[model samples]
Target: MMSLYLLNTKNTYTVAALMEIAKELGKEDWDFSQNPCDGNPNWVTPTGNLSQSKNVVICTCAHNDSCHVVNITLMRQDLTGVLPPSLAKLPSIKVINLAFNYLNGTIPNEWASTKLEFISLSGNRLSGSIPTFLSNITTLGYLSLENNLFSGKVPAELGQLKNLYLL
Candidate 1:
């Protein structure tokens, strides 16, 4: 069996950033007693069930033996807050699935500086036109903005993402 000590603690900066993200998303369930890299219920749930109302934060410790959040899945949570700009503070985040929530507001401008790969914001009340800054996240591969109240034609700049397969 793996020892609990093998799990690395998230850097204080990362922890602070995650806490801000939770506050912005109205998520009060995050358990700070355990490190974000610990395989606990709040940190890592049983599955990626987007149909269920749950919050999951996942981190990776393989690189440099330090913990870094890699994925966050908070779906059907009925979260009544805006998309968090604090998400950009985690440099290792690759996938963020916040689908089926009651969240409003458009993606934050801070996200333009992220190295995200996949993002699913479907089934929300997000409004405002899709930002052209999305194209700035050159590493983005998949993006889902469906079922939102956003108006205006898709930005032409999004075509700049050569790795993007869906938008």
Candidate 2:
């Protein structure tokens, strides 16, 4: 029963980030009138279960009495635009997948400080060498940048990620 206002401050920021994403991607089907978590059925997974929704998933922290976004998946949605830096504002986000879209731009440097575990931007038009700061994310385990326009040698710094199993 999480409402937009009831979510934590970080979650509110994530909502704004999502708005920017929807706008940039030309997601005309995005419904702004409904609560992002409860209103959009298309945002949910085909399994017909709320918890399994592919578009957005909310996680609750009972110890802190707060709710936050943990994952965002927008695969093959025909989205276009630069990856917004606002996405880095989701304090509790662990996974981000925007593969198979038309997005282009260097991955935002602001994301270097996040606690993400998985990031995938494959099959897009993104350019620029992979950020070295990505190696700083100790929690990162999966990263995908294939089929893009990136240049430069793979950073040896990426070898620093002890938990990273994929590139």
Candidate 3:
């Protein structure tokens, strides 16, 4: 697997460009196909006094032309500010696991376009209604929005995701 430091260098450490580097990285052979934090106990980010800006690591490595499957996981970090809406532009995005952070904002409507299989946004300060557009993604399997300050009823449109196993 490519190291985070390496990814930073290759992409000039910008959030938008990192996705492209990640896609290229995926072209190479690697043992870990899923998010790196999946099997480790320390995968969870620690709370309290974490770096304010040192939060998320979003890697988008979806290949152009092909149906890219970008894998993203932001475990334990001190991420702040609104999530960049441009993230939804990555067509190959599949898994998005972001648990235990200080993200405060609304879930972007654009996220509905990605045919995501796993999406976890637990333990954050996110508010507002869960976008009904999420139902547009039919491939969603795992979804979690617990422990957030989100108000409003869960959109019934999400019921259309037949593959969802977790909420």
Candidate 4:
């Protein structure tokens, strides 16, 4: 398969290394970044730690509708560290592609409040029980937590997500 690169806004990494980051993130990051490249021109510059870029890859949505179109996909960037709870504040986010990475720790309980439609967080080192608050995120359609360190029984409250099509 061909590889894709997600450049740091500084554009420091070689395309080859960028492609490697995309691959480690699950190949989905490349796809999301590509969709908006045609018309909307979606781009994400690494804000912090180049070595752990995915952890800081925040979605900067435009205020006006004209520039508000973003697919918000960055699945396999090989991101590590705990997901920042601040991420739940992005109300404009639609799709969050964080599939393959070294992400660890608990899924933020505050994420239950976001307007996320698709959330992919498989293949990480996450632990602790799935947050019960996530059941309140009615907009979530696709949720993936496969291949993680999460233990205990799956919460029955998760079935509360009526709009959930995949889990």
**Candidate 2 lDDT (Cα, whole model)?**
0.75
Candidate 2, position 102, lDDT: 88
**Candidate 4 lDDT, tens digit per residue, 63-163?**
33222222444455666756646545444556776677788888887677788888888888999998888888888899999999999988888898899
| lDDT: worst 10-residue window of model 1 | 1-10
> Candidate 4, which ten residues in sequence have the lowest lDDT sum?
61-70
Clashes of 2: 0
Model 3, 45-114: lDDT tens per residue? 3455355422223343434312223665655554565554655665667777667777778887767777
Ranking by TM-score: 1, 2, 3, 4
Instruction: List candidate 1 segments past 4 Å from native.
Output: 1-10, 47-51
Model 2, runs deviating above 4 Å: 1-11, 48-58, 61-65
Per-model TM-score, in order, reads 0.88, 0.81, 0.62, 0.61
Report the C-alpha lDDT of model 2 over 1-167, residue by residue, as the tens digit: 22233345645665677676666666656555455555356554555654422455445465664556678787777778877677677788898888888899899888888899999999999998988988888899999999999999889999989999999
Global lDDT of each candidate: 0.85, 0.75, 0.59, 0.60
Better of 1 and 4 by TM-score: 1
**lDDT-better candidate, 2 vs 3:** 2
Model 3 poorest 10 in a row by lDDT: 24-33
Each candidate's number of clashing pairs is 0, 0, 3, 3
Residue 132 of model 3 has an lDDT of 85
Tell how far residue 20 is off in model 3, in angstroms.
11
